[model samples]
Structure formats: C-alpha cells, structure tokens
Target: MSKFKKDGKKNTPAVSTASLPDIVFMLLFFFMVTTVMREVDLKIKLSQPDATEIEKLEDRSLVDYVYIGEPTNTALYGTLPKIQLDDAFATVEDIQDYVIEKRADRPEAVHGAIIVSLKVDEETKMGIVTDVKQELREVQALKISYSTREKVNKKKF
Candidate 1:
C-alpha cells in the first residue's frame, strides 16, 4: 500500500449552521418586544404648530387624545374646524360625555393623573381650542396637554 493510501479516510468539508436558528429567534424576539402597534387611525388631517418648549409624554397608557381640525373630507364636514373624539366628529357639548367615559376607564387611584392631549391643526383658530378647554374644565378634567411640534435649533458653525 502507498503511504497516501495507508489510512484512507477523507476529511469532509461542511459549514455548521447550528447557531442560525438561535440568531433568527433572537432577532424575532427583539422586534416583537420593541414594536408598538398604532392604537388610533387618524381620519382627519392635523398640522401641529411648532413650539420652543416641549415635553415628551412618559406613559402613553394614561393619556387620551382629542383631534381638532377641519375634516379631511371637507365636503362632509365643511371647511369649519371640528373636534374629533376617537373616530367620530364631536361637538363642544359632546366633550363632557367623552371625558366622563375616558375618566371612567382609568383607575380611581390615578384619576388626577390622566392627561388629555389636544391635537389641533396649525391653521385652526384658538376659538375651537378655547371651547374644548372650557368643556374640559366643566368636567373637571384639569390635566390637559397641547400637542405641538418641537422647535428645531440650528447650530451656527
């Protein structure tokens, strides 16, 4: 027997993918944990005004939203500004009922901490905002927030 053929076991070349499934599972779990689904679908168009002072909301669960703007489908709601609670257009008189319903959803322990965000369009007059504010006050929903775009500061090089 030749020297090369003395021990005739050939070395097999193969790539090990044993860790691939673990990597894929880790990535899937990462995305699943980080992703947040959109809670509300906005039917109306909102152009929020820019503001110098802005504060980020820490807990999203305790906040409620009220949309104020001219309806996207202007033929239906006309050109006038209207308030939207959840999915439906609401009048100033409807605010009390809506506040009551939202307040009821929260636990009594944190009733004072519930925040109502007023998302109003930039072009919308303050009259509509004032009306909503007044209505909110009537229901004693004192914690209110004005949603606005953060003012960008340009650094002079």
Candidate 2:
C-alpha cells in the first residue's frame, strides 16, 4: 500500500558521494594532528666530494648530519678558516644544545650511541676532515660518516 511499492518498482539504494570529502578531510586532519614535525635548525652549505668507493649505511637511526664549508673571503689574499661541524656548533649552539638537552631528558633518545654524518666540500683539505673527526671524538661521538652522492653519469655512457 506504500506509494513506492504500489508502482511495482524496486527501491534504489541511496548512493553517497557527498560523504567522500568529509571522510577525506577527517583523515587529513588526523594525520596533520598526529604527525611530528621535524625542526631543521641549521642552514649549512656543502659541496659533496666524489668517491669511487661507496658503502651502504647499515644503521641510520643513530646518525646526525653536520655540514662544513669555508666562509667567503672577500679579499683575494685573505686566509680562509676551514669550517667544520664543531665550528658550526660553536657559532650556533641552539641545535646542539637542544639535542643534548633532549638526550638528558630522555635517556633512551641517544641510547649510548652517536654518529655524525659529515658533509664537506670537495675542495676541503684532509687536515680539515681529520680535525672535524677529532673534535667530534673529543665530544664522545663514537661513530662518524662522510656523505657522498653516487655517480649516475656512468650509466648514460
């Protein structure tokens, strides 16, 4: 006796495309709220050195990145100081202090392991690299790594 049933036509299921946006927005909001934003506190300029031997990193969780570069010398004869990771920290203590403080607050943050990924210019001297490594060693940074880019041009040839 219903108006829809009297005609003998099947009742069509209600399709919803309207709720799609709401669902998507809810997911977006969830991700936005729950995701941790990594803070990049240092702006470093570095030119990667070329290397024939490349090694894959087995452990990445213990790594921290540091960049080294020579400051611009306006005078042609001016002596340029070799800038390294520790030197950078001396200039800007905020990032290093934050990490150290965080480690103190959470003992598991560092977990008795430290690795520094050093990014340096190709023109940087070996002595400079050694000095940087030594400085980090003094700070009890047990692990050190040099960052390098893989050569891709060989594949084209």
Candidate 3:
C-alpha cells in the first residue's frame, strides 16, 4: 500500500498566462495611439447640398483641388493677388494648357488619370459652375468631382 503525503509534491501544471491581459491591453493602446486620421480642410465657405447616396473618392493619388472666391474689400486683401474674375474667364486657354502640362508632370501612379475638386462659394452662380465644368471638359479632364459635405445621421440599409 502506497501512502500519499503532502510533502514536496506538486499536482498542478505550471504555465505562465498571468500577463496575457496586460500584454493585450498594451498592444491595443499602442495601435489606438499610433492610428492616423484623415482630415479635409474647406478652402471656401459653401452650403453643401445634401444627398442620400454617398460616393467615396477612390483615387486619392491623382487629385487636384481648386478654390474659387471673390477678393475681400479690405487692406489685408491688398496683399493677396486679386483674382480678376473677368480676366480669369478670358484665361480659359491658358488654364487648359497648364492642366495639360501638369498632367504630364504627374507620376506613373496617377498617369492618364486626373480628378479636379472644385470648391466654390455658396453664392456662386450656376453659370459660373457650368463655365468651369466646360473648361475642364475642354482640357479632356473627364473625371471631375464637386466638393460637398456629408449629411449627419445617414440611414443605412
């Protein structure tokens, strides 16, 4: 008959899982702290039209932004280059030539692809928008996008 004694005898297996929660929490905190967030800055004040469908811009590499606004009537405005709307309208040919030059300069990643993001003021007339679109079309820039803000609380199905 063998006698069982409680002296210098171990019955449980030894495995170290004590620090697992701490390690997991540390990794989670590291990822949360190092994450990068994308932010879009508005160059002009405009009341964006609401839309039920949201179209995400897929190609980020081949994109250029244009800001259109009237010059302010103040001393500070004098320091900035005055954008003569009349003259700007006449420079349609020059603008098209510049776009072609810029398109050639773009890297292969965005080669043969160009997207223009037009930011216009809320008070901007439809005729101006049409004119800008036509100019872009003449440059053979078929991929055009109008800037607009997304509405909050969009219902998802």
Candidate 4:
C-alpha cells in the first residue's frame, strides 16, 4: 500500500509581468531625460588652458561653440591646430558664414545676446585665433569668451 497518492494534475504557476512594461518604460524615460547627446563629434584633442578666474555662461541656449586643437585623426588631418565649427573642420573664412547661419537660427530679439565661446588648445598659436576673431568682427558677432579650466590650488603642509 502506498502511503501517499500521486496527483493527477500538476499546478502551473503564473508569473506576473504586468508591471514589467511600466518598469522598462520608466527606465527608458529616465535615460532619455538624463542623457546629453553631443551635437558635434570632435576629431581633435583639446587641452583647455587653466585660468585663475573663470566666468560661467549665464545662458547656454544663447551660446555657440568653436573648437580649435591638433587633429587626433592623423590620417585625414595633419597634427596642426585646426578649427571645428559644429561637426566639421572649417577654416577662418567659414567663421562669418557660420556665425550668420547660427545667429539666424535664433530669435531676432536674442541675436545681440548670443555669445561665441572659443575652446582652443593651449599649444595652439595665436595666428589662427586672430583670424577667427577678424572673421567674427566682420560678422559683427563680437561677444566672445575663451573656455578654460579653473586653476586647482595645492597648499604646502
């Protein structure tokens, strides 16, 4: 005689996944909101100079960026300080047209409020920068700022 009887039917457990979709969607939204998508892909390496005093831009929307550095893409561009406007490598002559197009993208009221920030490598010569400045001046886009890292002070014990 058997002490226990065998069950005719096995119980099928149901896993609850009703909230899985919500959790996945929440994670997706979180990443979407927190992530910052870079507008330009830099082909150069830039080491920003250190500064004793640095001022932060008040409004980011009213600012445009220009990058100058030695090209990291050695095969395409040689190892010299080159200008980058948005995603492409550009020349001094492109500055005026670039500024005009960028300025035109903004509202008319904010045209005067736009600031052009230059992120130039410390090793770069001033000649290229001077040319960029002249181009900006020609376009009447005189508001300019040099991007630099804040100096870190170390005290002797």
Top model by TM-score, which number?
1
Ranking by TM-score: 1, 4, 3, 2
Any idea what lDDT model 3 has?
Answer: 0.60
Q: What lDDT tens digits, residue by residue, belong to model 3 across residues 31-110? A: 89997443344333445565546676777657765555444443544422221221232233455665677688788567
Give candidate 4's TM-score: 0.75
* Reference-based TM-score of each model: 0.76, 0.49, 0.53, 0.75
Ranking by lDDT: 4, 1, 3, 2
Off by over 4 Å in 1: 1-35, 155-157
Cα RMSDs, all models: 5.8, 9.3, 10.5, 5.0
Query: Per-residue alpha-carbon lDDT of model 1 for 35-88, expressed as tens digits?
Result: 987656776789999887889888888888999998899888788998889878
Clashes per candidate, residues 3 or more apart or on different chains: 0, 0, 0, 0
Pairs with steric clashes in candidate 4: none
Q: Rate residue 156 of model 3 by lDDT.
A: 78
Lowest summed lDDT window (length 10), candidate 3 = 81-90
Of 1 and 3, the candidate ranking higher by lDDT:
1
Pull out the clashing pairs in model 3: none
